[model samples]
Target: MTSRKAEEIQHEGASGGWGSVSGMAKVLLREKPTPASLDTLLHQNKPHGFMCTSCAWGKPKHPHKFEFCENGAKSTLWELTSDRCTPDFFAAHTVTELLGWQDYDLEMQGRLTEPMRYDAATDKYLACTWDEAFTGIGATLRTLDPKSVIFYASGKSALEQSYLYGLTARFYGNNNLPDSSNMCHETTSVGLKQVIGSPVGTCVLEDFETCDVILYFGQNPGTNSPRFLHPLQEAVKRGCKILTFNPVREQGLVRFINPQNPMQMLSGHATELSHMYLQVRPGGDIAAMMGMCKHAFALDAARREGGEDGVFDRDFIAQHTSEFDDFAAKVHATTWHDIERESGLTRADLEAAADIYATAKNVIAVYGMGLTQHVHGTQSIGMLVNMLLLGGHIGRDGAGACPVRGHSNVQGQRTVGISEKPELVPLDVLARQFDFEPPRDKGMGTVETCEGILAGTVKGFISLGGNFVRAIPDQEVVETAWSAQAITVYIATKLNRSHLVHGKASYLLPCLARSEDDVQASGSQSVSMEDSFSHIHGSVGKRKPASEHLRSEVAIVAGIAKATLPPNPTWRWDEWTADYGKIRDLIEATYPDQFKDYNARMFDAGGFYRGNPARERDWKTETGKARFTTPTVLSAVGVGDAPGRYHLITMRSNDQFNTTIYGHSDRLRGLEGSRAVLLMNPQDIERDGLHVGDVVSLVGDAGDGAERSVGGLTVTAFNLPSGCVGGYYPEMNPLMPLWYHDVDSKTPAAKGVPVRISAGKKPT
Candidate 1:
């Protein structure tokens, strides 16, 4: 077998060893952030301190001295960098000139110091007062119909800010509250809600303590959530086994050395995580799930035939779940031949995995966007639920389906009713509270928002925080559609490509990052965030603001709401802005069942659990039971093979967060200094008569007739399953057709774009 390596690689011993320490120090030294800002990491992921604002992983009840991970450190340091995007900088560079700069270079220019409005005549963004910018934006918003306005929120938003922002949108007369969740775990929301009648995951951080087995469908913990490694290491110490099904055999899943462990760090001892690691084909999670489930049924019958109690949890399935017969029928109908071909794994491999799964008393199945960003992403989620249901994992202690959310408050944002779909939040309760009729229009999501913009229906766009244009798939479509908007307003901390993709009228409003202190009239207020585990906690910033002009997200949202809408007695914009607790009190009113005693509860040590009804087997669906969902396609993405075509899944580096590129380095994967690279299996590369380091052009087709292509991607040999390839996102994003997405969830099919590789020339 040929060696799997990138052109320029680093030899790191393992994930989160000295390598992680080096990476963290490298970021701190590179950015040269303030010493006070560096010291604030001691408070990261701790009580009465700011949340990491990185991943949605729950903090420990008692965390280590340095609770944050390397990635978390990078995200914070990157945000707190002293480099500033001053008015002088903008004056020196026009929008067109800045647009030509690399994404990393543009953001490295640093944080926006003040509000800026695009000057068409000068082709530059001119500094403007907050009042002037807000007044202009509010006037523009007031002129547009609410349906034409896309109120977008980033996952990093605090629960308070998210609630206020959502309210601001609804108060403006429509539910066009599209957010980062629409692009990410929307399939998880759509899928889990259908099966369990809840959108959030059931497992808490403490659940890892008692869980015997963890199954990672597509989650890469080392990069996605490095703090997650601590739990995995602990679980492994307690004899808990992990099984993974992914195209990439992520080193994090294989081994990890906790930086907090002095002995381990000194000795460089790494803990082995995955007991069984199956390199499932890209977009093959559904087929693999089906095979496991099918084996479960076979084992159950075999045990029953032996005149002993069966391995299956018959009583739990019978009482807690419905449609068992239908689910079993579908599983039985799926042939072993199809499963092996689709999953790229042998029957023996699956049976062995099933054996391990069957022996475990408690198991937690966790997943990331690898399973969600596909054409059949929703169905893939359904298949996972079906497998777990057969084992009666739901509602059991230390066992359930856990969707590993990427963003810190993405789940919290959704919990606060940031959705385009109606019936998610209680509109009547909102109307009763605010004394205004909430519009019932079915609004837009990320994909729908792009379509609306492309069709010239979406005239206004307002984002809380995110690289909106770069984050979503169908980069070509979004880039074209972005200019169709009449107005664009971004409440952000740093500069990014999304700002460069300007509308007819554009405004860039700087906002305070999570680590910065926000002093309101009431006091130095803390923002509350909900983790992926559904735990809500208070986050108090200790570091100074990036700029004096930067406003809190809560203040900005309230300012917009007060400016755009007619003043109602119920809308106490000043009181809410001055004190975020007041906003939490209203959030309690909006979601009394979940957020009761919201102010007091969040202060509880390690915060409070928002409790999923599904965890208690209290079904919120019409059937009043956790239902079994059948899948139409037993594939991660419904794509067929064509000559030279490969399944290209999007990836993130260890040095990068969602959309925020820290640097051009991925230490764990051995690749560095370039994101414009394609990872191909050695066998595939050899078969295609290609050499490592050869530049290639990727032409993508979703059968939408819109052939999208990007050239000059360096091809690197990797240990992926045959016919599977990997590449960094935003770089490979253009190859994914904008129109192609999940049918049920409408999430972009980023994980499995049908791409063909050919010889290409280097970019000038």
Candidate 2:
């Protein structure tokens, strides 16, 4: 057996100590853990089905045997574990004591057994009945100005739960639904709605199979959506041309070994996924995409001058699109020099990518937060749509724009009106259905919500799920704003750091996990989830509840609504909570065209397909056609003063979710036991006079008077681009300044933060 470094060992020994460090070692390494126990555990199911709440990354449950990734398995184990956080347990510890524990240690304390109310006098959480909790919440809500309240939803929530939450909030006289989407994919929804009149992806999972070429930009599905690996592997095996453009050369993109495939698993064979990989700068995605489009347009022009037919989709452009000439002119006017400097890719590379696009008959472009978290996020997406429209790749089989979602059903949640700004149709239907005049005013989004909290305009917060404080940028400011609230309510399954940052009146209501059986008044119920491909699936939880006191999210919302609202003759909150299907019926009535016979459609096949505007080549724009959007050249924000200051791109390890770390192990990056290592290019290391394993401090030149130093980082040189560095997320989130965010999207540009890296002893 080979001796691995302390940083390279994933699993702890019996004494809970990591392995020792060795000499120079390879960077990319993987640990193949045995899955026999996981397979056995998944097979012996209890009732409905098992859903992992830890991460949005999931695979379709297969018959005969179900396969799971390491993180997925860890998530399942955590949910299925025997640990419990009972009321008596909380009585023994003060809020201050619990706040002192690490995030992992808090969750490791186990599942929240019951609803808890913060007792300020005792400085501890006391167990409360669900009815009591709801009554208290309702009283607090009823006293506050409705506009001062924010109903925040997370992606982990079910669509049915989200629908009820929306109704409850609107019925309470406000549409301030500040959800997780506002932080992650608000730009995607905003931009797509403007261009196509729909925010969801135009393609389905099946599209990946038939596409001749798939252009992936800014996402590593291996970590974010591990289930996408199977499709990519199958696509490559069939000779599909897969091209990738990312700041980092993702290990999952280069090669993928399907754990589901018995032969491959037995033989330890991995399939080559990406045929061509281009390393773009952190915020250079827009330029690279635009450059590709420019080259494609030039090619189309040349072919047309030579009297060639079918070079570009002229008929499609003329019939289904507007502003093509202007968009084309802007592309033509863009100088190659500017594109090269901005994108950090040469003209030759852009032409090569263009050549691939031109030759491939069926193409699909997939993007992730890498494209959406930048200042130019919206414009970047529009640019990709422009490229697809130019070649008429969209609205066709195996070709379209796929915005790979981070959380499961995040797209579905948005579809059901979990938005800060309510759509016209949903609002109208909501008003007609409930008989109350819906508020016409646009509500505050995530950024605006934080601003409102800071300005003392927002008074109360009711988050359905998510660790908002940890996930949001400028942690210090977000924490302060949260503390300023009069009341803060968190409806969650387990403990998190967010619970610690409580308000004057705080409540932690425990809810049944998605993988747990919910025997409500109506009967055993099921929730619907929409995947990246627009396929809606029915997920019924089969596991036992973590605790009998844990109420379903729907029930909790109904309880709150009943306590707060006066009895309305038109609506039945009690009846709806008794049965979720009735809520679906209301949803169908709201979007009759999309969800007609909602219950019947769900039982028809795997699930029902939501309306995909691009499938029929229909442009639902205000002009009844797709409009080409042209964005001006924008300058990138410099991180620090120095030129050689490395721009740090914060990313999640394979072993971690957004803010939850299952363990300190990143198999692909060859890091273990610790996540405080910074991956730098060898040239950068030599130029900066640093060596591997050297502890360093990253100093940010905080514009405002604040702490400017983050320390105790171990340096490791790898195959990264020069003047660039990579580190784990959440931990490195502190380095990102509060003001460092995309101008338009307000999304923290976590991928690109300019910092000065110095090698020496860790800061005291």
Candidate 3:
């Protein structure tokens, strides 16, 4: 037998061992924090400590002494650094010149200490008082039509800040509220809600304990959420089965050593994570799922033919689901040939996976952007739900859907009404509570917001903390759209690419980080945030403000609202901003069932879980039952017409979180000193008449007829599936046209873009 060692050929790392601990220690040392700072950093996710501002995986009910992950340590230390970006730093650099700096360099300049405004004449950001900045922003916004202004939020903000942000936008007579959710999990929300009548996942963290099988459709949990490995480790110890389906063999899913375990750290022994791994092609989740179901469906048919029972869950389908007949018909009609062609998996391989899934009493289907950043992302989510419903796995302990969220409070921000298309119930509640009617007009999401800016319809943009310009697709188009804006305001803690990509009039209003104390009229405030599993908890910052000039996001939102809107008695912006408890009271009054006793319950140990009807086996869909969807195959459309073209999926390096580049090196991928490289299969390289280390230019083929390309990316042979290559995002984002996005959810198809690659230059 030919020995094709997976680990030797491809770069791999058993995540979370001494390496993680050393990395964490280095980050703390580089930040030069005090003993108290180290203490606070270690307790970042504990009961009273501030939440880690990284991924949104829920914290354990009983957290260990050290629950922070490697990335979490980086994120918090990055925020709590002693270095400061004072007004002198801004006065020394021009926006035009600063644009040439790399993202990591820009962020490493440290936290923003004061407000700064763009002076077009001087071409530099001049120091300005908070009042001056807000007044100027308000004046520019007031001059434009309310519909031309868009309010955006980031996932870092607490629920109180996001609530105030929404109210500010609505009271200003605009509904164009967009946020980070649109860029990542909008498909999860849109698809799950259409089928299950809710946007959240049905399973909690405890489900991993009892789940017989864990099916990872696309997520790479090691880099995305390292803390998630603890539970998976525990599950593996119990001999639970883990199946991973992705285009690449992610090392994090293959092997992981718990950094928190002293014995494991001392022994240097790693736990094998995935027992079964499938290299599903990019944009192949739908067909792969269908192929697995095809085998299960056949087994159920044979059992029925033999007059046997219980393989198909007939009772659950009849009582808790609808449209199973149509779903089954479509599943049966999908041939194995098409499945193999689309999924890049043989029928035998899929059947083996299917047998494992079918034999398991309880299974959990966990996925990430790989399944949600495609043209058919919504349909793909429905397919996963259908598979779970087919086996009667849902509504049971350790069995349901789990879409891993990438932001700390992305879900929580949406829960507090940071949506462009705000629901009517919240609108009605706000209208009654605030003595004003919110506009019912459908608003622009993240992509649409950029489109509006490019079209000159949107004149003002306000972000409550995000690198908006770097986060979206079509970098050139976004830059043009941002330059066209009349005013661009950012409430942020640190400087990033978005701060340099200014409009005709721009302002940077410095704000406190999640780890900073927010002193208000009611004393230090504790803000609430909802995790990926719908658990709401209070986050109280341990450190003092990074700077005395810095203000809380709540105060900034109120300041903007007071400056822009006419004074109204019922708006009560002052009262709400002064006391966040009033905001919680309003949230409770708005969503009584979901957030009943919101503030009081949040004081409990480990917080409280906001109940979901789907998890409780209560059908809440339009049909009064969980609806099964018969989705048409859509992966075939991802292929470009041109030959020698490979499908490109932009991804994050292990060192980075979202657009915030922690460093240029990706330690997990074994790349150092630079991120200007592409991972390609050796077969694809030979077929394209190219070699490793050859610089290549990628031209996107999204049927837009516009030429979009990025050059000077070095290609390296990787253990990836054929006809698929990988590129780092925010750099390759220019190749993704604004039009190439999921139709239903409006999320950029960052995971599936057809591209033609060719050699350009040799690496220096």
The residue-by-residue lDDT of candidate 1 on 1-764, one tens digit each, is 34544222323347888888888888888788998986789888888877888998988788888999989988889989989999999999999899888888888988889999999999999999999998999999988888899899999998998988888888888788888888888998988898889988888888899999888988888888998899889899989998888888787888899888889999987898889989988788888888888887898899999997787888988888898898888888989999999889999999988888888888899999888988889888888887778778888799999999988999998888898888898889999999999988788888888888778898999999999998877786778778878899999999999998988899999999888889999989888999988989998887888888989989998888888999899999999999888898999998888888988878677779888999998988768888888887767675787777898888888878888888877888888788888888887878887777889988875666776888878988777888888898778888877666778888888888898887865434
Where model 1 places Cα greater than 4 Å from the true spot, the runs are 1-12, 761-764
Q: Which structure among the candidates has the greatest lDDT?
A: 1
The 10-residue segment with the lowest total lDDT in model 2: 15-24
lDDT of 3 by residue, 1-764 (tens): 01343345577778889777777777778777556677777677778777888999888878988878989988998899988999998888888999999998898888999999999998999889988987988888889898889898888788888888888888988888888889999998899998988888999988999998988988888789988888988898998889899887887888898877788888979999998889998888888899988899989888889988746688898988999989988987888898998888888988999888888889999999999998788989999999899888889998999999988899988887888886623787788888888988887899889888778888888999999898888888778667878889989999999988888999999999888788989899888888999999888886978899998999999998888898889878789878999989988887899899887888656668889898988876789899999987737234433577778878888778999887765666666766888888876777677767888888887766888888888887777888888889788899887877887988888887888886797656
TM-scores vs. true structure, each candidate: 0.97, 0.90, 0.98
Q: Quote the lDDT for 633 in model 3.
A: 74
TM-score-superior candidate, 2 or 3:
3
| lDDT agreement with native, every candidate | 0.86, 0.74, 0.85
Residue 707, candidate 3: alpha-carbon lDDT: 82
Candidate 3 Cα lDDT to native = 0.85
Residue pairs with colliding backbones in model 2 are 6-20, 47-542, 48-541, 48-542, 49-541, 49-542, 204-533
Q: What does each candidate score in C-alpha RMSD?
A: 1.9, 5.4, 1.8
